[model samples]
Target chain A: AQSVTQPDIHITVSEGASLELRCNYSYGATPYLFWYVQSPGQGLQLLLKYFSGDTLVQGIKGFEAEFKRSQSSFNLRKPSVHWSDAAEYFCAVVGAGGTSYGKLTFGQGTILTVHP
Target chain B: EPEVTQTPSHQVTQMGQEVILRCVPISNHLYFYWYRQILGQKVEFLVSFYNNEISEKSEIFDDQFSVERPDGSNFTLKIRSTKLEDSAMYFCATNRQFADTQYFGPGTRLTVL
Candidate 1:
């Protein structure tokens, strides 16, 4: 079985500051990873996803995540945080083969608070 | 841009009552899914539907839970007998193809009183 762990429960950063949210996963093989964001009372929006190729994958809203196989991590990062970026973020992983389609194991999540 | 849409933004139902949450996925999408998030928990996948049938489901989707695409556009999740634990924000998502990018709709908040 695959699982995901997000070490940070909450993080606060000032506007224009750099931000990083850590995520680690346990999977037997190369996995498909994704990052999603959800504002209060809103549906989750996909921030980025990593299937293969480059270790660093860029996504919408100027966000990016690096897939580190050695560490089993896919941490999301943004160079400059905007106030609007404040939201709860989740890291998820899906297994590689059979029975993996649409099966996503999500991390507990990390709430981000951006301040001016 | 085309997007998934869910109905009844908020639903309040008594425990043991039946409730249905509806969604209309993007017209061309071939895969549809239902997920739920408890008030303070991570989102969990409940079930996935493809080719007009269920392709996969989680343990959370038991006999009490069922999904249907009664029409060409509308997909629904029906809870036979709701429990307090079932109270959560239910989301509907669709992907152009299996294992591809998925787009989510505004969730329907179900409150089982």
Candidate 2:
């Protein structure tokens, strides 16, 4: 079955620590990948996306993601996490063609907790 | 920067009652989509509308669910007879074209009791 998986349900780190969130997808072909963050009582905000070209994509709020075709992974990372970065992160994928086109399949999401 | 907007940030309704969630997508956007996220679950796609008609829809978008752009500005998702399972955060997203980046709205939290 084609799906997106975020292995970590919850992650905690001290302020200014580096962070990495794992994401893996099972699909026949390469799909459009994206990462979105949601603050409490807020909407989903686009953090970054990967379509083609560069394997490492940079997004807002000092976040970046690397797409590894061999491993079917698109992991998100931040060099220095801020307290405001504590939120739920979702990884999604959309097929590049055929019946699955434009239909976004999202992962279960990983919640990040930042401690002062 | 343009953003999508949804009305009635939150709503509470009894089961079997009808509910219409509204959204105002970016004016320049040409495609619109709807998705729902249940508590502690992944977001699921419901439907997509283009040129005033549904171009694609998932199994979740059944008979009870309908979408329309009645006034050419406001996009709406109507659930004829909502069920308890329908309680979730419904989101509206739009993009200037298909296969492009989509902008999602703040979302409307629907609580069906």
DockQ of predictions, in order shown: 0.71, 0.73
Give the per-residue lDDT digits (tens) of candidate 1, residues B1-113. 88899999999999999999999999999889999999999999999999899999999999999999998899999999999999999999998776777789999999999
Instruction: Summarize candidate 2's per-residue lDDT along A2-103 as a digit string, tens digits.
Output: 689999999999999999999999888868999999998788999999999999999999999999999999999999999999999999988877776477
Q: Pick the candidate with the highest DockQ.
A: 2
Looking at candidate 2, what is the lDDT of residue B57? Answer: 92
**Residue pairs in steric clash, candidate 1?**
none
Q: How close is candidate 1 to the true structure, as a TM-score?
A: 0.97
TM-scores for all candidates: the values are: 0.97, 0.97
Clashes of each: 0, 0
- Measured with C-alpha atoms, the lDDT of residue B95 in candidate 1 is 88
Shift of residue B22 alpha carbon in model 2, Å: 0.4
Angstrom error at residue B4, model 1: 0.6
TM-score of chain A of each: 0.97, 0.97
lDDT of 2: 0.93
